[model samples]
Target: MDLPRYPYHQSLEQRSGQPQRRPVVIVGAGPVGLTLALDLAKRDVPVVVIDDSDRIGEGSRAVCWAKRTLEVFDHLGVGEAVAREGVRWQRGRVFHGEREAYAFDLLPEAHHKMPAMVNLQQDQVEARLVRAVQLEPRIELRGRHELIGLEQDADGVTLNVRTPDGLFDMRADWVVGCDGARSPTRTLLGLGFAGQVFEDRFLIADVRLAPGVRPRGLDPATPERWFWFDPPFHRGQSVLLHAQADGLWRIDFQLGRDANVDAERDPERIRARVAAMLGSDGFELVWSSIYQFCCRRAERLRVGSVLLAGDAAHQVSPFGARGANSGVQDADNLGWKLAAVVKGEGDDVLLDSYEFERIEAADDNIGHSTRATDFISPKSALSLRLRKAALDLAAHTDFAKPLVNSGRLSLPTAHVDSPLSTADAEVWTSGPGPGCPAPDAPLDEGGWLSEQFGRGFVLLAFGWPVQAPGLRVITLPAEGVAATRYGARPGSVHLIRPDAVVAARWHRFDAADVAAALARAHGRPQ
Candidate 1:
């Protein structure tokens, strides 16, 4: 589907005048860029987002968005539309040659607001984010505006943007590259990637069928993730199936490395494959693509005033859905820090934490992605045989089922060693450790623990009154989900960062201590 396009505006340089310098210029209008733009704009920071293409994502590239990413979206003002439009699923069933192996549920809790994951087309995500960007007066989203050159000094970064009118120089206090995997920004900075590339190939097909088309194993009304290892129809390879929103189903065929991409993607071959897998051919093929993934990331995410996020900083196998989700979190991580620095509320050292935190996140994601990739594509003869044996054993024994890895799925990452984290002075039952994301808990009257985070420094104290500048406080009961989840005791306080990460927690602390922690989080000397 074609997405609505915005009119291109010429910069002052293109109008035969000196280039206009802005506070922040973001190159790329993908989910990450738009998200960052929205966040910075919401913080009263003027941001200009430039994109090479006017259209949204061509295909349903990243279909599975994780819960943590949704929370970030909720802060950005597009979470409602995303949740309403996406298909929600929590349970997954694995099959070994037509025999059920085991089942796993990522989010079994019913008290939370969001699901374990949501399935929405990438285009749809971009559409909502783009619309939100357009409505923000502080943001200028220039679609079809391409970035041609980038140069940075100690003080600022300048970019050469090519619009329909002409190529013009645009300067900014900082330039962020959310341009994607083949990021021109990263290349221009001479900061490239280094990592492993698995030789396995996968073919993705999105097909639409009637709501009544029910397969034997699948429940037409309820959605679940289904994975098969060496099914009857397919030889030794694996297959993954997911039910998407809009009456669409996604099938991923584990085509071997030597498989012909051209022949396999042909409609007739794809139809035949679908027919054999479904035991009937009654679906319309919507799209098909072949892909091979690399578990890699850039050497560095930040250099001077230019920074890289999302696929630009890293590229991972889609088995875990880490690429886009982590990218969204990267934007979330940088947005508040960048905005604060632009407004002179924080120093550039705060921006340095973006590299520290997100690169750590990128490594964590790459590790998971690589593990899933290796499991999906075993190397040696013994490895292949062992993989099959494990899957076979998984069909019967519960112990063996845990060893099976049909894509480990996406999980939120923890920044265990972030520099901003203040160590806990005393222990508590369920409180998140410093540098960990604050867990969601059910509130007594009506609400959630996550609802209290994401705006500014949040002080969660039980049975005590604490207040500081730009700090929000939440009073928890002596006993409840919030109390237990936070290990909240009387006089306990937990300081949460704007990105919902715990900066510090105390069994007992003073208001001055909280102020110092906040200053440290903002890269100021305490």
Candidate 2:
């Protein structure tokens, strides 16, 4: 497949004298920024996305997109292309010295719209998103525009952006940072990025297998991931193998802090490592990089009119594919709230939920990544002994299998205590609760319930509309997956927020109660 290049395009009408003002100015047009732009545009809020790149990034970075991210992409209108072009996998295996230690399945459920994970090249994913952004009427994507400076105050933010033409000042009601680890937006805010930096550096590379080449023991037909804990080929280090789209494979090798970064990245050296593991050096190396990443987050995600999302908001080690996946979810969570605030339908304080909920999510992912990293690359001899004992025991003992953590993988974070939730008025069984992403189900007519979301705040009613425009109602019969998933009675109701999170639910429907819940979701005082 040919690579994708996004030519620089200037869609925003330039301000010659006074800088033009927009509702939202997004910096960095990666997956998260593009998703936010499309999302806000769908909500009828205009957005301007600024990025320095003229093309999708090279290589397959962040290839493991999780299922929940795919669901959010469906609402953004690019999920079909992603699901069609990506390689789907759920099962994975962990090996300890050539012996299979354990095998696991990520998504055991059968009815999900997408699989547990999809391995698509980062460039391909960005290309699809770029196409969507270009076609969106309400979004202006300015490529090769560098955000050199930002200043925020009471009403809005002023950004000094440098384009190929020249530097110009622009203003927006809000400025969002989707910039990666080193964020200019974060720097402008003087935020203290705090977290632990792991001592080990990782070598990540993508390689295309020859027409008939198969790694010594890997099955070209199977999509399962294989992780090694102290493998024979790599000696003390751990390695990860993933099958990607287009007959490509991603290999991650752990290099201790002392490893010479330059020497380790040489093509011949990397090729020799692959030959050691695969018993052949026929694969063509596509890209290789040596870098150290930390699991950290900004001191705060929201600071007045300027906010952070994606890598700019927080970061985690690449072990669990938590970085990009969580970043996409961050954009999804903030888009509706920001749109509401901009359109006067919600209080500006509604943006608080973005900070509270996503920070909670960031902490959760950091905790998982930290534990996975420790397990993968033990810091001390004691830790190494324990990890090895566990992996070795996992080969024969079921109890030990549960202890092996080759990255817990990524799972949707439930915002159980979000301030936006109204708490269940009464007890209910089954289905999701307040602050949980709505449980998707097959409609009695043979579609998905989540497919009906992202259209703004709506009520999940088992029967009919209960007379509230603010809570637009959708009826589902009391006898099917919808009923079982929602735990709803014939007349019960569920208030789902615009972002598809449950704001509240009740065993009985009442217009007055649902209205109050809707207001609460918008950050209106009770």
lDDT of 1: 0.85
| Stretches of model 2 off by over 4 angstroms after superposition | 1-15, 463-467
Candidate whose lDDT is highest: 2
Superposition TM-score, candidate 1 onto the true structure: 0.97
**TM-score for each candidate, following the candidate numbering:** 0.97, 0.96
Query: Mind giving the per-residue lDDT tens digits that candidate 1 earns over 290-397?
Result: 898899999999999899999999998988688899999999899999988888888789888899988888888888888777777888889889888888898778
Q: Give the per-residue lDDT of model 2 (tens digit) for 415-452.
A: 99998999876778778899988878777777788788
| Model 2 steric clash pairs | none
In Å, residue 170's CA in model 1 sits off its true spot by 0.5
